[model samples]
Target: MRNSIKSVFAAIVLSIGLFPLAHADDALDASKLYKAGQLNEAIKKIDAVLAQRPKDAQMRFLKGIILTEQNKPAEAITIFSKLTDDYPELPEPYNNLAVLYASNGQYLKASAALEMAIRTNPTYGTAHENLGDVYAKLASQSYDKALQLDSANSTAKLKLNLVKNLIGNTTGGTNPKTNTSNPAPIASIPNTAMVATPPAKVIEPKPVTPTVTKSTAAINEKDNVLDVVESWAKAWSNQNVSKYLAFYAKDFQTPNGESRNTWSEDRRSRIEGKGKINVRIDAPNISIDSNVATVKFKQFYTSDRLSSTSRKTLVLSKQDGKWLIKQERSGN
Candidate 1:
């Protein structure tokens, strides 16, 4: 999470490192303060700049970074959000908002923000990577919770291990537990001769301990489905054709009444060639019935040349231990 946040900050820093928002000297001073790790001083300097140019986008963006560095997440979020509203075409603010949301453990909000970032700039590789990392983080949290609820759940354990392995590979971190020889078992006990004791009565096995409450399991299941849907939306916004297609089953119904192959090609053209696309999913209604799940939501789509709002529903099927979209349609 820190890595994601830092990468976003690095982008902002590099982009505006030499751009002066205030008077030459003051901007220099502020940049110095920021580099010196005097976040409070940097904030003061940037605030002075903002005072002169109230709506200065660069100044506001700088101040937001300073606030975040000062450990003021709420303030930082407000600043970034305002920037996003004021400069809807800029992807940086949305990326910054995602960093703050992830820091606050609001993965859904973070995912949404990153999606918007990619939509605002479909070629923004940073946002795409950050979105992937967010998915990994969400998966990590879910699988970790599953382990906590049921240590004996082999599936959960295996999934968690796989996630950790992915994270480790991405981060290039070594597994500390690897290659460490175990301490030689403290000397094996010597064989001892013992007289046979009288046969004891057979003991009944103890009742199995309940690993998870029904309420907790329900919540986990709901969260897992939500994560998948969020990821699907993110992949679409990012114009990640491969990842987007992977979320659907081979039998997925085409919303445009076209054959699946034609539909896929159409989606690819629209997503990959659109100048900028912003997709937002809101107020999702999810219902589960065994292996089948239904999700309804408001989808807000925008691009450089057009915008629309529509109700959308997705029918998902649990196949091979994963949720895949089996059908989708637009609604009133």
Candidate 2:
């Protein structure tokens, strides 16, 4: 599986004209081990190398990849963020950072990172595919946009198909809309994630439009969010390219002045390391107005494989009558 993905990424990169432009100081040995699928060994080798040269951005980036594959995404995020801060000109760190976002259902952050990645290297197919996924997530968030948006966007269409394929593969034979909606009881979540405080003011809500409950609806919007969040967790648990992304309004900002996209993506990857995961969401607080709603839950995590749980807030809205997450943020 690893080799196949590498081969595909390489071919995709070559097809798009990306040269293997590792910096002079980059740790080639670790890269080779990572390319060979020896993730743990690559990590150790890079750790030794970085121990001697802690400031090497390329080495850090390479180590981040290995750690991510090893289900150490939080560490990966730290490494990648450091690489980007230390060497903002490099595109790979941004792309990898996007990967972390994607794996956590933080699509907006994934999209933003891919944009930066593309700005640095137009030929980076990983960024393109990732951006495609982000667009696909946006489409998922707003079906009307799917129909209204340009059909010339082959990338979005392709990514939609890819997401469908991935969901299909992961969900046995059930339709993605159905499979992801089947919510298991909330299990214990990792204690590592922060819990966000929901709006305390009980703003007088508008009349609730009666809709099918959790057990029904051709597409249970709330259930769908649960499933998507579940799938996002599973994707990270499996180290599936760390492209999980959640949607949030561009206007949504955290108390700390962080955008919903940035805050949510940061915590999502922090807790959902790249391994197995057991999860539980606090009693969900859901509110709807017309086709828009907010699904507030404190996602808890266990320490077994995927450790740490952060409080999670997902803002969901309806586009064409389908519920879509537009924003996410976490508080612990």
Candidate 3:
């Protein structure tokens, strides 16, 4: 059976685009063995090279890939997990981790890993695409559970079928790895008590009119806030450093482990030096309470050489009738 998981794995391998490791010729030899399907020899060669340069990220990455292709997922997971811990700035390992997690039917963990991958490199297109697929899988699980609980429930049945159709359309009906000739339980989600609906009764119309007005106002406010956030994203995408910086409040909290000035300089250089960038937002969830709003969404970013999708959160404070980001975070 054709597997989307394997397809995603192939994309990661292609997207690596990294230079050779310190032991360049040896690493190249190992890579050739891997491509020729001699995983054991590749592993041995890569390990020999790693003995001299244990900290080479590229070699470690290759080893991880070879191990994964060799059906040693647990070992591959260990390598990728350690790489993320040691080199938090690299997005590839996190993306690979998500692939493994998803293959194991751990969609939530996969989603989290993809989020981290995007967080490290917001311009990673592959991660973003995989995240959307993961979300669909999650929705499928939820719908399936509803069907399991109420076998005779027409609404639940209809919803489940609809979700399945959606999943099929989006992912070409690719089954999760948990499904084989004989499938295994993908999750241990417990069933909740389904409340029986009482006979319909007449209610006062007073509650309805005011609720609609309030909802409309809330929606408008949310749209306004989303526009501001979208504009900020656009500025960054366009590589307008000054306009991007302007979106942040004067007292905007700096990123963890970096001084504000240093962070600013780094952001400026990264944005300006990269020739072109494209950023797209998806499924923005915005919550507002008084003068504060929390916005979370998937951020799709692309430059000439890099692309990713990551989860981004913006905490905005309404001041002087304008919304400005006070704090921003990516990933989990």
Q: Give the Å shift of residue 75 in candidate 1.
A: 0.7
Clash pairs (backbone) in predicted model 3: 123-301, 123-307, 123-308, 124-307, 124-308, 124-309, 125-307, 125-308
Clashing pairs in 1: none
lDDT of each: 0.69, 0.53, 0.69
Which is the leading candidate under TM-score? Answer: 3
Clashes of 1: 0
| Candidate order by decreasing TM-score | 3, 1, 2
Give the C-alpha miss distance for residue 56 in model 1, angstroms: 0.5
RMSD of 2: 20.7
lDDT of each residue in 1-332, candidate 3, tens digit only: 12243212222222333434334566557656765667788788878877987866666877776676566879989999988765555677887787777767788998999987775566677677668778877887776777788788788768766765544533333333321122111111111101112225557666553455888988988988988887787678767799998888877899875777888898998899786576767789999999899999998888878989899999999989999999999996
Badly placed stretches (over 4 Å) of model 3 are 1-3, 6-22, 168-332
**For residues 79-112, could you state the per-residue lDDT of candidate 1 as single tens digits?**
9998786556567788778877876678789899
Off by over 4 Å in 2: 1-28, 35-38, 144-332
How high a TM-score does candidate 1 get?
0.48
